[model samples]
Target: MPVHRVRFASVRSQRDPSAPAPSVDAREAAEERLLEALAEAAGADEPVTALAAILEDADPAELPLTGAGRTRAQWEILATLGARSLAAARVLEPHLDALSILAQADVPAPSGLLGVYASESGGVTLTATRLTKHDDGSDTWRLDGTKPWCSLAADCTSAVVTARRQDDGRPQAFLVDLRHPGVDVGEPAWPALGLRAVTTGPVAFDAVPAVEVGGPEWYLQRPGFAWGGIGVAACWFGGAVHAARTLRAQLHRRQARADEGRGTGPDQIGQAAYGRVDRLLRAAAVVLGAAADAVDAGELDHACGMVEADRVRGTVAQVCTEVLQTVGEATGPGPLTQDAGHAQMVADLQVYLRQHHGDRDDARLGAALLEDEHTGAEAWW
Candidate 1:
């Protein structure tokens, strides 16, 4: 199989051995250019294309977004972020501006992908923690837990984990080395419906020693940490778009064929079915765009308000399935022989859309709402 790779534009090298450390002005200038490029790439009109550019052109040391301007690097970050959260934004903003610099510097790959879980008596929470206390007055945390469904697990060298300090009840975040004895990458077993390319697998950690980044308070104060849900939505949106486009074109071609054929009657039912699928896809796109904007605006509640992210997360699968069904019906169940791309796209999307499931549904949103009620927060609009 041809693995997807990150590609980037080349720039001149500026590194000189024995040269003094770069001044603040130089660093800022470099960072600014990278961020601008990233922003341009990760926009509404061209996210998939933007992702391709970011993966191909990032310089980690210069941008701190990708571990390198490599697909593996960007994949690791995307996996670690799990596709949602303000933390992802925090990680995204700085590097989006200066990706080219990192692409040129040959930055190292990020640590690993199983560092986002918090070991709790209740369950495995996707919250950041602080467990280790290191020297220099800096706290080093330990992450000792298992994480299921990590993306690009084969490429990460380390992970940013969620754990707690033995001395305090507070949660903490740790950046742990994956090569350590405790970190064990597992087989890719996410046989769900979608994103098979993402390597959604399990990771086991036997008490991995870790370095704290921002302390417990800082890490906990970050976003909802449900970045995967967002990625689910993104993938879903992509699939939906693909399905809609494919079906629309198929309909047009079919309509033209029917008009030119010796058929006794018109395919009214087929036309209606195609029309409905197209409408759903159009609506999904609008909803998806709004949700993405809300997320970028640091408005989790608002984003969730548009329709729980989980619902939006499942939209791609639902929409794609509907489209496939419609296409199948329109073509009279001839296995959709002519629209192979549409079929493959639907297949690929189905593999990725399984991220939305039982516990991951809007029901969780309701539960979260109930939990908020205890804190005097309104549970509903």
Candidate 2:
């Protein structure tokens, strides 16, 4: 079959002839031009570069939100899915998430630098990284020690990290430049079977200059924290959708083969699998949409917001797991072994879904629900 190419940029150009073309890097410009030519190609390639160019051309402040200007949380679900379809969500989602966090926290980020959030502090155990405020009369802050699970550690130009305050032992968020002196991006430690492109590893800060982003404990206490948690679920949902697409394609191929006397027709087992996955995905979408609406309505301003976010994330994670099992069983090992994209999508979805905290999160939700019930608060229907 001959591939038809459709350049997305050309469509925009045709719509607005007088729109000014923003200046971009020569290499990026060349890549965009090439992609424009390949838009109608049977297999569109270089989705990461294409998406990056589109994002760069727009002002970060004006990105659309999901659900009637509901917080960016809802919009993230669609964005993540689009990136996942191109097999680039692992590389792009974190950078976008960082930008969203900074905007929510009201942190001023310089234009064009990719931002990362690396605030995993090992729960109760203090992270090796520590932020110290010197007695010397200056606004200077210094970061020292090692931070683990720093995604995009080497690639990000800047990061928002959590460290224990030397003065009062409170955890605080600090913005630091990766290019500054005394910052070392460690060798990659994320050699897991999936998300190889994410590049998560340790980062050592040796008196690296930084500025505190918010007040002590503000990062977690802020409404945006819950909003961000739900956003991760959106990415998981997107990846799941991509995995489900493989199963749908395989089913179609089997049906076609049967019609041509090459294989059997769709059977009861395939029908059941399709039905279950369809229902699960639909339910998940509803939950995500409701959560997005709640966020936009400022429902996440209190404990209820956390409850809703946790429920949505847990429910979505369960749905993704079910979809993975259904797809694997119905399609067998053919797609896993024969299709590279399908294999990558399956592996990536499995790893990314682990972002959910499993029993811990469920327990938290259970306790909150019980508390609400005890207080005679309105039942969370």
Candidate 3:
């Protein structure tokens, strides 16, 4: 599929490698260009070309892993992608997460985009059976059954699949090449308004050839799980940032209209809403940034890992939810109806942020705190 490539103006903002340090200003300037390019690309009738440009430039493979003392940079790269295009972020993030998963076991994934299809929803169950133990002490395996919520399953060249052992019924992670004859990419059943460019659905495996990535249950048990979750929260934060940016843009134009010629503008009546959106988004940013730092510090490696993930995801999701509502109300229907960029962003965020389980996750956090006896005054902090 053809995609709209970013214009030279956008790539020019990327700082020269040998010129100087990639200071905060340089990063922000480059990110600003990316955001603009994505906004321009979102309305294209092509494939994910703008996002592909980002991948080419960012080199997601070389990105630092979580808890690698540079986790902030990793999350920031994802956040920047999310800010302009969640559909792009939706497809790109899994590849990055899958790479991190492979890196955990020092297993090399097949070249090209990858997917992480572990969710076993819709009453489907994938089972893995050991096929043969090679003389090199490597065991070949096969996967059977269906995995659901597989975003870009058809597009990915390979995937890190999670399947239960046929004999012991224990979960295990396996690398499956999607091109296998036994692998079936289901019909595109994605019926959603957001992230539509990434057609997510179920995939069936019938004795698909595979290789294990790590030991049984290693996928979720790894520290990268929580780190990955936090990374998604950072995406949520970035999505909200876009919504806030939209709100700000709308208010400024109308305010200028009121100040000069056309007195019919809201006269900055929506400024308060913009203020709320700004404050909430900034707070969400701080929360995610701090969470990235915590992951790198190894503070959330094992102890209360899920709790921190839930907290950060929940906080960012809430901020995004409010931004959606606030921006919609503040801008009224003008932007939604007239501006394709603003409308597409709102719709995309609505679907993307739904990945968070909302109150269910909050209940889990409460239950975890109670069960762990983690009650204290400073704990409130």
Candidate 4:
């Protein structure tokens, strides 16, 4: 039977016709040009270098930010779509997200410090890194410990890291110069199956000089923290979109061969797979859009922001996983084994989605919801 003869057509065409179409002319001409440039540069041999060059050429002040003119949700859509275009390009998304959060949080950054947020505390629970304030009558801080999962560790000129203060033992945000003496960017600890181009590893800060970005616990307490978390989901969604494209291309090729009477069309199973991926993508998009809208409306400035961000993160993570599985099963090993880009995208996305803290995050959201109910503030409809 023809692929279109399956229920996939009806399922895909179920969009509400009465709903207004999303605006395509949202970005300014310059922004559009920058996006095009980034897309082209994303395919470069060194994507990080290309990203840095693009950032240097573009006016940092004019760069897109959440809640800046355009709807925050729309910005997320654009961001995810951009990331989806190139798997390697996903590396730049986190830095951009950090920049956006810093701006939103009103955190002061040192001049000429290219920001990469390296606040991953994955291994810190077992072994905490301390950044003590050096009370030498001078405004200097010393970092001593190893930070794991430092993405773009080597490429970033500076990074915002969370280190416990010696004064009070509270985790605080600090800006550290990657080039500073005693700061060691360790060997590639990310021996994962994907995201090889975006080098991440353990960074050892041996009494490295650092400047505080915000007060103790300010990094996690800030609204931008939650916003930044949701932005990660945007990147995941982008990666999933790319994976979906591989499946789509495979289906198209099969259909073309069928049209030429040279091969069989997509089977009912293939159509079902496509439908599943479509539903996952659409659901993830809706969650992201809602989160973006919340951010734009300043709903993320309170406890609600954390809940909403958790929702987006969890939803996007699930969608990406489903996309990976569905696309893999639907297209078989052809794309994974033959298409380098598809394979890399799959690998990159798999590793990236692992950033989600799984049940811990879900538990946090659940507890928050329970607290909301106790306070009669449960507005999660």
Candidate 5:
């Protein structure tokens, strides 16, 4: 799908041709389409096939490009998908992020699903070596070693991967074809509680052919790097939204029963818990919205991307933590034990939230402030 065209989910009335599309409408529409496709493809023999079907149905242009004026629409869709299915959102968000990344680099996305894998770990790294180009002016390279945390490696046909260049020792982004003969997707570390449907594990590449995207250090230096991180926070926030909704549902059940004179209404404690959840969730949403607007306005055009992303990600992570804690306390062990969906959501959110570096990220932010004499706390204030 062209990034230029958009097709909303139509949760409300169809968009008026003269009017701009709203973020909430796009979110609901995409969620409806995704939920239906997931329901229809639920019984597929393989998870990858099911995932492919759902993704193939979701138009790449469903939400406008981030910073294309409808940036909030992009995040709203991400949050709703996270609310519906983090496993599914886990796969889809990167696919969408890849589209924006490719657009930023003036590269046309290849047909089929794409993944954005940038993570690396100790003792396991993917290295890129330039290969002799064909007479057709192709810029190809070979990749070797293992790239960790490659979610849906088997499902994606292609990916925008970041690998350390052997010549320069600097990381560069590449538009890689996962179908290359030298590529090998390893077995997932299964039985994991969160994002179980998404096959996230190590991928071993042996001389895998690839096409370089932007030059060395281009991927991390790009503004999309921070925008992409904020997208993940959008998923985290959405997961919290669902968790709060689950608690709200339990409260409603209690209140309904009490209205019939059969049980007591929501007590002060439960009501207080809901209030706290609501406050945190809305605050996070506001931060996300402001961040979206800033991106669209090109406010982070310089090098503030890292600082901007850390603040939003850290705030959202803290809120998610508090919401999970309060909900668990208010609802007790019933949802954890009795409700499978709620249980899975809570577990998935917990594991996904770990992507946020917690204190390490906080320290990074504080250090940024302290190291730069020009950067005072009042700048943030």
Candidate 6:
């Protein structure tokens, strides 16, 4: 099917209440179309360039507009695209293309750069080092540290990474190719929670032949950091939106039956939970939308500094947990048996939520909102 047609059809699918909400397959098809359009425009067959364009152009709001706020449109776009990562990674097979695309967009193709590390001890310890040429034109450098919890490392060809130069002690970023002789990818080690399909493994590189990105001095200045955060945030946001929609459907379906006096629908707890989940997603949508707008406006510095990425991550985290709890209670074992979609969504959300767990590094968000006390701390309105 043509990409445009698929997208249109998927949109139409939304109208039928009984129809399953868009699945990972639909998300992947849409992403494939996007990748094709981007590849054609960059005039480069390399997947990195194409991936970069899509990441750069994507409207984050599409994924999961959280609130009924001013940014509804933007969140919708982000949630839609965010839902496709697993599917995208699956279809883009060989991992190089997807990894390269991620690196180009600065999304941290964890394993490719050096290696991805799982937080669990059973996971392999993967590391990447940076080598740089100093001002004296001599090849001298420093070695930075390792990052844990790399998602999608099992198949990435290379990763865009951050490291410190050993010689002079400066931060640097590199695109580490997984095919390099020294690169090693560990077996998948993630304990299932969500997003089980995407390989969350460890990659280890030992004194590998490395290529330097730009000049060593320009390393810390890379925008890839923000992009990486945004990518993960988008992916999580997508999962959350799917969860909300799925739960909402089940709730309403039950409610419909209850209305016919069959019992089960909108109980007080379910009603309250549904309302809370809706509000959470709505707020997430607004915040993520603003972040995307800031990116387009070239306000990346501000966006990154504020709770830009966190808004997406945090909101999704809360909503996914709440929705799953609510829907699971309302449907009981019925959803578990009859609706694989709900179960899958719950699993995916569990895994995706883990993305925000370990090294999210929210220090900046804490500092940014220190002065805005009231609005920042409150949960409602």
For all candidates in order, the CA lDDT equals 0.47, 0.66, 0.75, 0.69, 0.80, 0.49
Which residue pairs overlap in candidate 3's backbone? Answer: none
Reference-based TM-score of each model: 0.57, 0.78, 0.85, 0.83, 0.87, 0.60
- Report residue 246 deviation for candidate 2 (angstroms): 1.1
Clashing pairs in 4: none
Q: Estimate, for each residue in 290-349, the C-alpha lDDT of model 6 and write its tens digit.
A: 555555455455334335556555654665676667667655787667776556656776
Q: Candidate 1: misplaced stretches above 4 Å?
A: 1-57, 60-137, 163-172, 179-182, 189-196, 213-221, 224-228, 258-266, 301-311, 314-321, 331-344, 358-360, 367-381
**Model 3 misses residue 314 by how many Å?**
0.6
The clash count for each model shown is 41, 6, 0, 0, 1, 44
RMSD of 1: 12.2
TM-score of 6: 0.60
Query: lDDT: which candidate is best?
Result: 5
Ranking by TM-score: 5, 3, 4, 2, 6, 1
lDDT of each residue in 159-268, candidate 3, tens digit only: 89999999899999999999999999999877777777888888989989999998887888887887888877777666777777787787778768878988666545
Over the stretch 314-359, how does candidate 1's per-residue lDDT look in tens digits?
A: 5645665676666666655343456554555555555555546745
lDDT tens per residue, model 5, 1-381 = 111111222222356788975566656566556555653453355645776766765666663576667677778767866776677668768988888888888787787778998997757888999978779665779898889889888889899998999988899988888998888898888787887878788888898888888888988888888899998998888788878988999999999999999899899999999999988887888788778878887886535767778898999999999999999999999999999888988989999999999999989888876765653322476
The number of residue pairs in model 4 that clash at the backbone is 0
Residue-level error in angstroms, candidate 1, position 218: 6.4
The TM-score of predicted model 2 comes to 0.78
lDDT of 4 at 374: 53
| lDDT minimum window of 10 residues, candidate 1 | 1-10
lDDT of 5 at 41: 51
Candidate 1 similarity to native, TM-score: 0.57
